[model samples]
Target: MKYDPIDSNLFKKNRKKFMAQMKPSSLAVFNSNDVFKTGADSTMPFKQHRDIFYLSGADQEDTVLVLFPDCPDPAHREVLFVTETNDHIAVWEGEKLTKEKATEVTGIETVYWLKDLDKKFFEMMTQCDTVYFNTNEHYRQAVEMETREDRFIKKTKAQYPAHNYAKSAPILQRLRAVKEPEELELLQKACDITNHSFRRVLDFVKPGVWEYEIEAEYLHEFIRRRSDGFAYTPIIASGNNANVLHYIENNQQCKDGDLILMDVGAVYANYSADMSRTIPVNGRFTDRQKQVYNAVNKVKNEATAMLVPGTLWKEYHVEVGKLMTSELLDLGLLDKADVQNENPDWPAYKKYFMHGTSHHIGLDTHDYGLLWEPMQANNVFTVEPGIYIPQEGFGIRLEDDVVIQESGAPKNLMGDIPIEVEEIEDLMNK
Candidate 1:
């Protein structure tokens, strides 16, 4: 891991919170993500499943965590199974966590090798009537690939069909939504790294620079600052490309007068920071660009202020849409008729500002949070509002990651990053 070690107490607290919600006589299991294959001899990078990482602080593959708070034996209450390391394996793959190291990292004193998992798990299963399985239930999830967790759940069911099975997704969704103090610190670090990268881009971007070049600049700064690369696939959209919400090809050359909408972030210690900023290709924004940019910035500020406790996710978006409607009207993109005749399903503001203004941002870019529930303090979210004007040959978006507070306005994680039209122009020209 490039980042510094996280305190194991955080993981200890997370496990305690999760186990508190588990049914009596129940055991919960979590598996690390698979190292997916690219082809015959190549494989994609390993990313630990966020759920397991959240509870164990074990950022390695082929690891498993079991929690049985009701176990008769105290040693079996919380156990961690890790792949054993040997001389040959260590030479080939570097240092893997040993038993003592695993305990230090996860705060679970009972550690066993992966080879003994089946024997130990079977013994525990006999004592518990119910089992909790971690499943992906994020609202934006569209996973088709069978994961390590999937195979474990399938085999467990086949082996112990009589056991009462329960979903761990709901419990995790609620718990992971609210950031712990340690998590908030990591998120702030990620955002601070992103700020450095964005400032670098401001100095590097020129009229004729290719979008990929800007992407490379961001990557260079991220790695140098100890980040684990981007939080998500970056959107380095230039010109009308910004109109395509997920545009990541990054192959176009930025024209002199066009705006480049960059939806990018840095990840530190598995915590994610999401930020979106649109700036002119040239040193300064055109008058019209400034108008639209300020409008989007205003909407972002107001939308962030609405992220206080007790705000419903859906209702918050509805309110943000009204704010965008007013901005679009002032921009002359929507007239009185456009507002009056707008379809209730897709409002008039959809013509320009189509996407939602905010979403939970943390471990995963679109982190777990129940949409129906009211917002709470410590819930981190991205306040992004944009106006994509294809007809004008450019688009503008300004976003910031914010933490909902117990009182007053939410704290903007990306607050120090340049966003104002003049500030951006000054930095670019400097």
Candidate 2:
């Protein structure tokens, strides 16, 4: 891991909170993510499962966590099963966590090799009537590939069909939504790294530069600062390409009058920071570009202010749509007739600012939070608003990560990053 070690107390607290929510006499299991294959003899990078990482602070593959708070055997109450490391394995791969190292990292005193898992798990299963399965239930999830968790669920059900099963997603969704103090610190670090990368890009961007070059600059800056590259696949959209909400080809040359929409971020210690900024390729926005940019920035600011405790996620987006509508009317994109005739389901503002203004942001770029529930303090989110004007040959979007606070306004994680029109122009020219 390029990032520094995190305090294990956070994980300990997370596990305690999760266990408190579990049904008595029930055991929960979490598995690390699989190292997916690219092709023959090649594999994609391993990413730890967020749930396990949140509870155990274990960031390695082929690891499992078993939690049984009411277990008769105290040692089996919280057990960590890790892949055993040998001389040949250590030589081929870097140092794998040993039993002592695992205990230090996870705060779980009982550690067993992977081979002992079946025997130990069988013994525990006999003691518990219910089992908790960690399933992906994020609202935005569209997973088709079977994960390691999926394999575990299949094998467990086949082995013990008579045992009662429950979903762990609901508990995790609620718990992970609210940030612990330590998690907030890691998120701030990620945003700081992202700010550094964005500032570097401001100086590096110019007319005739390829979009990919700008992407490379961000990667260089993020990696140098101990980040785990981008939190998501970056969108380095230039010119009208920004109209495509998910543009990531990054093959276009930025023309003199083009506006580049960079939807990028940096990840530190598995925490994500999401930001979006549109800047002129030639170091100055045209009058019309400035108008659109300012409009988006205004929407972003107004939307961010609405992210307070007790706000409903669904109602919050509707309110943001109204804010965008006012901006669109001011921009002459929508007139009185357009507003009167527009459907309430798809408002007049959908013509320009089509996407949702905010979403919970954290471990995953689109982090987990129940949309039906009211927003709460310490929940972090991204405030992004945009206007995609294909007819004008440019698009503008502004985004920042924010933490909902108990009073006043949500705290901006990307507050130090340049956002004002003059600030961006001055930095680009310098």
Candidate 3:
């Protein structure tokens, strides 16, 4: 791992919190993500399943974590299974985690090799009356591939059909939504790396530069600063390309006076930071562009203030819609009739600002908070508001990751990144 070692206590605390919500005499299991294959003799990079990593801090493949808080045997209460390392394997694939190393990384005293998982897990399953299986239930999840957890759950059900099965997603959804102090530190580091990279891009971007070149600049600075590349597929959309919500071609040349909408972030220690900043290609925004940019920035600021505790995600967006409507009205994008006759379900602001204002941002780009639940302290979210004007050939979006606080306003993780029109103009020209 390029990132520094995290304290195992964070994982320990996460496991304790998860187990506290488990049903009596129940055991929960989490599996590391499968190393997917790209083609023959080649494989995609291994990305550990966020849930297992959140609970164990074991950032490796072929690992399993089991939690049985009410186990009769204390040693079996918290167990970690890792792929055993050997001399030949170490020489070929570098060192895998050993039992001692796994213990140190995870703070789980009991460690076993993956080869013994069937035998050990069967023994534990016989004692527990219920089993908790980790499943992907994120609102945006559209996975078609069968994950390691899916296979485990399928086989476990066939092996022990009579055992009461429960979903770990609900428990994890609530717990992972809120960030730990350690997690907050990691997120801040990711945001800091993103900040540095954006500043670098600000200096690199110029009229006639290809969009991909700007993407390369961000990637270079990210790896240089110990980040694991981008948190999500970056959007380096310039001009009309910005009108497409997920434009990633990054092949167009940024013409002078056109705006480049960059929705990019850097990842550190498996934590994610999401930021979106739209800037001019020629180092100066046109008067009309400045008008739209400031409107979007104002909407972002007001929306960020609403991320404090007790704010419901749905209601927060509704309030943001109203704020955007006012901005659109002042910008002349919408008239009074557009607001009066507009469908309540689809407000007049939707014509300009289409996407949601904010979402939980952490482990994954679109992290794990339940939208229906009221906001709480330590819940990290992204406040992104944009106005896409295809006719004008540009879009303006200003986003920042923030942590909801117990009192007062939320803390912006990307607060130091250049956002104001004047600041961005100054940095780009410098």
Provide the overall lDDT of each model, using Cα atoms, as 2-decimal numbers.
0.94, 0.95, 0.93
Colliding pairs, model 2: none
lDDT of 2 by residue, 314-353 (tens): 9999999988989999999999999999998899899898
lDDT of 1 by residue, 26-64 (tens): 999999999999999899989889999999999999999
What's the lDDT for residue 229 in model 1?
96
Model 3 C-alpha lDDT per residue in residues 1-430, reported as the tens digit of each score: 8899999999999999999999999999999999998888899989889999999999999999999999999999999999989999999999889999999999999999999999999999989999999988999999998989999999999999999999999999999999999999999999999999999999999999999999999999999999989998999999999999999999999999899999999999999989899999999999999999999899898888888889898888889999999989999999999999999988888988899988888899999989998999999999999999999999988889999889998898888998999999999988
| TM-score for candidate 2, residues paired by index | 0.99
| Per-candidate TM-score against the hidden true structure | 0.99, 0.99, 0.99
Report RMSD (Å) for each prediction in the order shown: 0.7, 0.7, 0.8
Give residue 25's error in model 1 in angstroms: 0.4
* Higher-lDDT candidate of 2 and 3: 2
lDDT of 1 at 184: 97
lDDT of 2 at 71: 100
Clash pairs detected, candidate 3: none
